[model samples]
Every structure is written in C-alpha cells, then in structure tokens.
Target: MANGGILFLWCSSRLVRTPSFLLIMSLALADLLMMLKLPIFLIGIWCQGPCLGLFGCEMYGVVSVISGMAAIWSLTAIVVERAWVISFSKLGVISKLKWYTAIEVVLLIWISAIVVSVLPLAGWNRYVYEGYLVSCSIDMYSNNFIDKSYVWLLVFVGWVGPNILIFYCSYAIVRANRRNNTLMMELMAVGGDTAQNFQKQRILEERRLWRVSSMMLTVWMGSWTPYTVVVLFNATGYIHLINPHIGMLPAVFCKTSAAVNPFIYGFCLPKIKGEALKLLKRYRSTRPSPENSSRFPNSSPARTPRPSIIHMISINNRHASTSC
Candidate 1:
C-alpha cells in the first residue's frame, strides 16, 4: 500500500499538467485504498474467522466495495479518455475539460459502486461468510437471484466494459496512425513546405501517442484478464476446479498495474524521465554521504570537480588540435 501510494504521488506530480493525469491518479488512489483495505480484511479474517462483527465488518465492507468499484470506474475513465484522444484528435472534446470534471466522474463512480454494494446489506442481495476462507462477497450460490444479477453486473461493468473500450481505443489509435503516415508520405512526395513539416510533426506526435496507449492497454489486459476470467467461472458455479488461492494471484497481478504506471510513464515519455532524473539528482545532492561521518574526521578527502559535457567537448577539441 505504501509503495502504491508513493507511485501514485510520483505519477500525480509528473502528470499534473495533463488532464488525463486525473484519470491515472484516480486509478492509483483506488489501488492504494484497495491495498490498505486488504490488510484490514485479512486481519479480520484472521482474528474473527471471516464472520466479522457488526462494526468492523461494516467498515471493512464499505472500504472493500468502494475501493473495488473506484478501481473499475477509474479504468473506465481511462478507456474513455484514450478513446476520445484517438477518435477525435484535433477536436479536444474530452481533453479540454478541467481536472475537476474527472474528479467528479470518479466520485460518482465510487458513490454508485458503494450504493450497489450496500444493497446486499439492505436485503436486496445477500453477503455472508461462506467459510473460513471467504470473508465479504455476494454469495454466488444464494437462493436470491439478486446475488447472481449483481455478479453479472460487476462482470459486465468492471471487466467486459473496460476491455471493450480499451480495445476500441487501441483500434482507433492504430488506424489513425496508419492514416497519418499515409498522409505524411503523400505530403512529402509533393515536396517539403512549412505546412508539410508541421503536418509531419503532428503525425509523429500521433504515432508516439499511439505507442504509449498501446503499452497501457496491453498492461491492463494482461494483468486483469486472468482475474476476471476466474471471477466469471466462480460466479457461474464452477468452484470445484478453481482454487481459492488462485483467485488471490490475479488480485496481486492487477495491483501490479498501479505499481507499474510510474515506471511505464517515466520510461516511455522522455519528458517525464528527464524530470525524474533531475529530481533524483537533486535528492542525492541534499543527502549526506557516509564519508562525511565523525569516524573519518581526520581524513577529509579533497572534492574533485565534476566535468561537464562542455568541458569534455573542449578537451576533445584540444586533443584533436594536438594530434594535428
């Protein structure tokens, strides 16, 4: 949880200038909350044996449901954002909005998710401790069809929904890139001009966007597909073949998506990577070196000046002159 939170903080700092950053940050926040909630749920299961008392269980249920739903909705928002970016490149329909609009959408997602989850507590659906293993989930095999309905609803909204949206975004981005490349070639064949150069640059930017979008879509699908498939099987009453421990693996895999976001953004985007390197250098400069300790007081080493790239270039020029 702490690591996920730190990554979220980094992503938030790096992406503060972009509107799409809100969606990414929201997903990170949701993952962080889920990570936090997991420990508490585990503790409850350990101490109280799956049947949590009124107070603790209620809080756990709320946190679990909220975080889970927030994660789904955040992914949905990302899919929508990517879709907009790819489908309508120059229009700026979705990207022009203020960050608060994204926040509002995220808030609504959580609110709706919590409302749906709380329905079971109110007798519309049912939640119970099936065994020492299962804590708080809709009882899949319950007599209430509401429980079954809720499972399918989550499967559709959380799993299939985002997958379809992301696939569409990926397809659109690829098609756009192909079209842009063809246009650029045609323009180049007509001879270079200021407008042609500008168009070429725009096409390059679109290609870059497509690459990043594809990477993110690949990660999301690879990480969450297993978990969703497992859930689908469980919901349909094929528990005999599925191990409970196997379900946890998918959750862990899905959590990795949050952790990987900062690294993905940093490595794939040169601007972000440069900023991260600068921050790292600044942090190292401020931190004290081990050689500066009192134990080495008698032996103060002389500080060597670090050579700049300009100095290296000058030295290379002098060496070439001497050789000549």
Candidate 2:
C-alpha cells in the first residue's frame, strides 16, 4: 500500500514518463495486482474452502497466472529496453515511449498471459485444488496426455522463452558496459578534475548496471525459477521423492517477488526516494509531536514554529531563501 501511494504521487508529479519509467510502472502495477489476491486467498484459508469453492479456485488460479505472467513479462520488457539504450543510445540518454508503442507492448504481454490463463477453463486442461488443497493451479500432476501437453506448452512459451530473452539482454548490456569502461579509461588517462568527473560518471553507470543486473537475476532465480523447477518436477513425477508440502514452497516463494520487487527497484529509484521523503515530511507536518502537545496542551493549532529545514539559492547576483 505504501508503494502504491508513492507511485500515485510519482505519477502526479512527474512531467514526463520515460520508456524505462513507464516499464517500471507496469512492473509495479502487475506485482500490485498479484499481491491484491492474497486477502482473497487468506479468506479462503480461514473458511477452510476455496474462496468461492471450486469456482473460486478457478478464479484465483486465473488471476494468479495472469498477474504473475504479466509481472515477469514486464520485467523482460524492462531488460530489453535497458539493453536497447545501452547498445545504441548515448550514456544517460532519456527517451519517452510513444503512447502507441507502450500500449502495444503492454497489450501484447497481458493478452498473451490471459490467453494462456483461460485455456484451462476452456478444457485444454483444468484448474484443481493443489498444495495440500489450500490453493488451485493447473492440474500438472494429472496423468492425462492433454494436461501434460499443456504443462509443457506453458513451460516453453511462458517460462523458458522469457528467461532466454532476459539473459540475452543482460549479457549484451554487460558487453556494452565493458566497451564503455575501455572508452572511459582512454578518455581519463589525463588525470585531472575533468578526468575525475568523467571517472565518477562512469562509475555511477557501472554501479547502476550492476544493480539492475543483480536485481533482475536475483528476483528471477529466487522467485520464479524455483516455481518453474517445481512445475517441471511435478510434470516429470520427480516431485514424488519430496514431501508434498515441501514442493509447495516454490509457489509461495514466487509470490514473494511481488513484495520484494518494489523495494528493489521502486525504493532504489531516485525519484521514488524523493517522493517518499516528501510524503514523510508531509505526514510529520500534519501530525503534532507528543512533547509539544504535552508542554502546551492549549497551544494554537496554527502557531508558527522555528524552521527545521532551510534552503538557500543563488538567483543571479541576488540570493533567494526558503524555509520549512
């Protein structure tokens, strides 16, 4: 909820949404949708039945597949965009996505997810209670040939394909960064203030690339990869060796990506951090301190207090000031 609130502020205050930022927003939105299903799941657990019985299970399964698929696809798109920029555009370049282009990619991603999600309902396979009957998913453990085929199709089209694309992009970006480092070294051999400045900028780029790569790899492995392994195990009858409850660990682990992602990318962004600080300051300003209220219980609500923060600026030959 805090992440959602900060996003609301970010959208309101942002003048231009670059393609990267737009992709990030899509990621957050998809993850948010996935997390929203948790309460429904909890309710179902509390009652000791599917949220709407079998039908509710179907609904939950569909929602989970769609949202989870969309989140991964969005991350894939983000990686692709980053690679595109690093490969072709100048360092630190910013470009806004064309509205139509953004719309098309987002539609393609979600539509593909929806198409796969609904197949079970259409009888290509079916949703069934799984994970000790607490949740529903595609009947991966079914012996039917049709169900087996669907699982294979889902693994290839939904999971393997995206993983390949993401890894390829990451590799390309790393190669591009290497080239950039060599160029930076040649340009900075002079050893002066200018060299120091260029060296700093290059280091920042390297750090940003490292963050993006590490976050992407960690999230993919820590969340989705385990679930993918679980699904493969179930499909192959390999899950029989493990305790049923233990096999469900991956499903729960994947769900956590929804929570971990926002902190990794959202809070890490400079703009989001700025907005968060603003929110904190705004909240503090509206609520009174316990010490002040106790010492002067009848004090004026609108009373002016000494500034806790001040800003100084140069306006040409004149100076300007502001305080908070």
Candidate 3:
C-alpha cells in the first residue's frame, strides 16, 4: 500500500496521464489492494485458523486470485504498450495513443482477471484450504481432472503466455531503439532538420520506460517462479517432493514484489525524478539554512537562457520511449 501511495505522490499530474503510465499505475494499484489483504491474513493467523472460518477462507482466496492475476497482467500491458510505442515511434503514432485507449486497456485487463479468478466459484474447479488450513487457493493437489486442468490452464494463461509476450516485446524495444536506429528514426521524424533539432529529439528518448519495466517484470517473475514450480510439481504427480513448509516459502516470496515495486518505479522514471528534484529544491530552500536559503528566500529557478521551440514537442514525445 505504501508502495502505491509513494508512487502516486511521485507520479503527479502529466506523469501518470499517458497510456503506458496508466498501465503501470494500475499494477501499483493491484499491489496496494493485495497488500490490504495482509490484515485479514494476519487475523487468520492470530486465530490459529481461517478467520470467519470457511467463508473467510473463500473470500481471501478469491481476492488473492484476483489481485495476483491483475498485477501480472498489468505488467504484460505495460511492456506490450512500451514495445508498441517505441518500435513505431518514428511513425508518429505517439500522438495517437490517447487516454480513452488506456482506460479501455486497463478495464479489459481487470475484467479478464476477475473472470479467471471467479472460475473456481463457477464449478470449473474449486478453492480449498492450503498450507495448514490458514489460507485457500485453487485445489491444485486434487486428483479430479477439472481441478488439475484448471491449474494447468492458469499457468498457461498467466505465466507461460504472458512471459513469452513480455520477452518478445522486450527484444523488440531493444532492437527498435538501438543507438543507430534511434538516430535514424529521429532523423526521419525530423525530416532533415539541423543537428540542434537532432539533439533535442535525443533528449526525449533518454529515459526508456522499457528498461525499468523489464526490471520490474524480472523481479516479479523471480519472486513467483518458485510458487509456479511448486504448482507444477503438484500437477505433475511429483507432490512427494514438496511439503507444506516448502510450499509456504514461495507464497511469502511472491509478496516481496509488492514491497519492491514502488522503489523501482519511484526512482526510475525521468519525469518523476525531475519533479522530485524540484520538490527537493523547494523543500531545502524553505528550511532555515544559513547561506543559500537566507540569501535567496523566494528565488525562483532561472529559466534556461535559450528558449526551445522543441520543448513542448519533447515533452509530448516524452510519452514514447520514456513512457510519460
């Protein structure tokens, strides 16, 4: 929850307005909601059983499935958007990526997550207590065919497929935004403009959103990969190799991603960093310092001596490789 709150503070106004940033913000929101589940979980633990008994277990299971799916799929959306924008940035499609499109994308991801999570309640499979009966999830350990099939289907939909797309998109972004290719695209976009224009264009692409996005995805996958392995072991009839205690570790590991996501996002985006810097300067100037603060109590930052024709264009273009 703090992760999402801190990100909200850093990503103010225009920073979170873009399509890609909206997806990223959606991921943070999912994590925040997931963290809110922690209190119920702790209460259950304190009771030495499921809180509210079976009903509590059911609710927890449903919420877990929903938030987990939402977070992972939101990562997919962010990376996919980054790849699309950066790969085709020279085509001037950045202007075409609008707020409504982003809102629709986020809504679709949420709807899909809800659908996948509630399937267990609809008799496709069913949730059951797991890990000493304090928590619940889809019954991956069951012998029933539908129960077994649901786990496999989920792995395919949530992990295998999205990861393939993530990797391919990451590769595409790298290929399309390589130094030479970046120059070529900028040259074409500028239509034989001066070197000064070339330099201005370069500034807009300096902070690639895909770079931080890849880091977030990698960390998220690393945290969940162990739980995935456990699920696979159970589904493949290798359950003897796993135990309840071992199973608990991976589930705990998965929560670490929620805690770490804010740091990655807060420090990584250029616009956030710029805004943070401005805020920091303002803060320091307001403090009772001896030299700088006293000498210029109300001094505003001096504007750059040269005015930029490309300033707005650069900021608008910030939505592309930089991802708002």
Candidate 4:
C-alpha cells in the first residue's frame, strides 16, 4: 500500500502532462484501489470470520472486478500505445500521444468495466460469496447456461482479448527493434557519423520496453491463470473441487497482482526515476537545513511567498505619497 501510494504521488506530480504517463497514472490509480479493497476482505475474515454477509460479499466482488478489469485494460492500452510508437516512426514519440486518444482510452476502460460489472446486478450473471465464503466472485460454481455463457464472455473480453493484444504488441515490438538494429548496423558499416551511439541508445530503449512488457504480461498470466482455470472448470462442470480452502488459493494469488503492479510499472521506467530524484531534491531544498538556518535565522525556505496585510498597506501608502 505504501509503495503504490508513493508511486501514485510521483506519477501524478511529475508525469501528469504526458500521454503515456497519464495511462500509467490510470493503472496506478486502479492498483491503488485494489490495495485499498483487499485489506477489508482480510480484516473481515480475521475479525468476523471468513464468511461475510451478502452485502459485504457483493461489495467486495464489485470492487475486485472493477479494479482488476481497469488494471488489465490500462496495461493493454500501454502496450498498444508503445507498439504504435515503435512501429510508426512518424508519431514522434509515445509520450506525446494525443490528449483525445488518451482520454478515449481511459474512458473506454472505466466504462467497459462499469458496464460489465453491473451486468450481474442487471440479471445476466450473479455475484456470490465463494472460496471459503470469504471471497466473492461471479458465481463460477453455477452450471446453468446463462451463467456459463456470462463466464465465457467475461473471460474472453476481460482477460483473453487483452492478453492476445499484449502478445501481438510484444511480437511486433521485437520485430521492429530487430529491423531498426539492422538498419543502424548497415548505417554504421557505411561510416555514418554517430551511428554507433544511436544504435546503443536505441538498444537500451528497446531492452527497457521489452523488459517492462514481458514482466507485465508474465505477472498478469501468473496472477490470473489459476483462477481462470478454476472458473472454466466450474463453468463446464468438469471439476467438483468444492473445498473452500482449495478454491481460495487462486483468488489469493490473483490479489498479488495488485501489490506487484506499482513496482513493475512505475519504478521500472527511467523517466519516472529521474522525476523521483528531482522531486526529492526539490523537497530537500524546501526543508530548513542547519546551514541555511544559521545563515538566515528568520528566513524560511518556501516555494511561494505571500505578503502580510500590513506590508501591503505600507506599500499602498508609499505609492500614494509618491503619487502626491
């Protein structure tokens, strides 16, 4: 929770204007919400025992699905934007992604999450307490056709579709990086000035992008795959794994993604690191050091200053006298 909170502050403070940064901020915000909600379930279990009442269980399910879906969609948007930037040289850079496009993506993510989340409330599927009766989900244990179809739809739209896009973007990025490296090498062979430096810089950026993308995809897969498998089995009536203890494991694993996303997405970026250092320096400068206090006892380090009313009145009197 602390890590995610700090990262959210850093991203919002430093990178608010950039397009890619906005998407990252969106992801961070979703993760922050997840961090907030999961503890309630834990505390409830510890205090009141595993099985929360119907209201609490339903609330947990709503929050989990919304935040989880938003995180996944935000990641999908990030990978797609990065891939577009790499493959299309004319876009200039990923950071400058148009405001309209960024807003559209964010809107789509939240709206889709809300619409899907409300479907159960609207009578399509149902949210019920599951997994030891402490955790809540989309009632995957039901074998009816409506429930099964809704589960399939949710899995495909919420998880499978995004994963496919992420994978495709990853592949395209690799191909684009290879092609760029080849061109850079050929230029170097022809004695192009600064070709080697350019090659090295591009290599570093490609490596960073690859690392970030792979880590995100890997975490997403690891966190959700078990739960997905369990849900599918339940939907198809192929498995009768009815033990609450066994059923809860996948849900617990999936919650780890909420904690893991901040580290992977925020701190991994060089830009974010630079911004963090700058902010730290600014914060330190604004504090009253011993040396500064000794040099000027009455002066305090402040970014902005406001004059007292008395001072303003004195200034106004002096202006009147000069005018007279």
Quantify all predictions' global Cα lDDT against the true fold: 0.65, 0.77, 0.73, 0.78
Candidate 4 lDDT, tens digit per residue, 41-127?
A: 777677756556777777777888888889889978988988888788633543448988998899899988888888888888788
Q: What is candidate 3's lDDT per residue for 74-128, written digit by digit as tens?
A: 8777778777877777566653457898899889989988998889888888887
Ranking of all candidate structures by their lDDT, best first: 4, 2, 3, 1
For model 1, residues 1-324, the per-residue Cα lDDT tens digits are 433533544655654446566666666677777677556556755785654565555566566567667776777777677657655764444446467877788778878887977876786655544334434555544445666677677678877887787677677767766776676676667565876787667778777877777788788777767756765676667766566566456555655675675456333456555655676688799987777766677676789999999999999999999999
TM-score of each: 0.69, 0.81, 0.73, 0.78
> Where does candidate 2 stray beyond 4 Å?
44-51, 91-96, 191-208, 286-291, 299-324
Residue 283 shift from truth in candidate 3, angstroms: 7.0
Query: Residue 76 of candidate 4: its Cα lDDT?
Result: 87
How does model 1 score by TM-score? Answer: 0.69
Rank candidates, TM-score, best first.
2, 4, 3, 1
Q: Least lDDT summed over 10 consecutive residues: which range in candidate 4?
A: 2-11
Residue range with the least summed lDDT across 10 consecutive positions in model 3: 202-211
Clashes of each: 0, 0, 0, 0
Local error of candidate 2 at residue 296 (angstroms): 2.7
TM-score: which candidate is best? 2
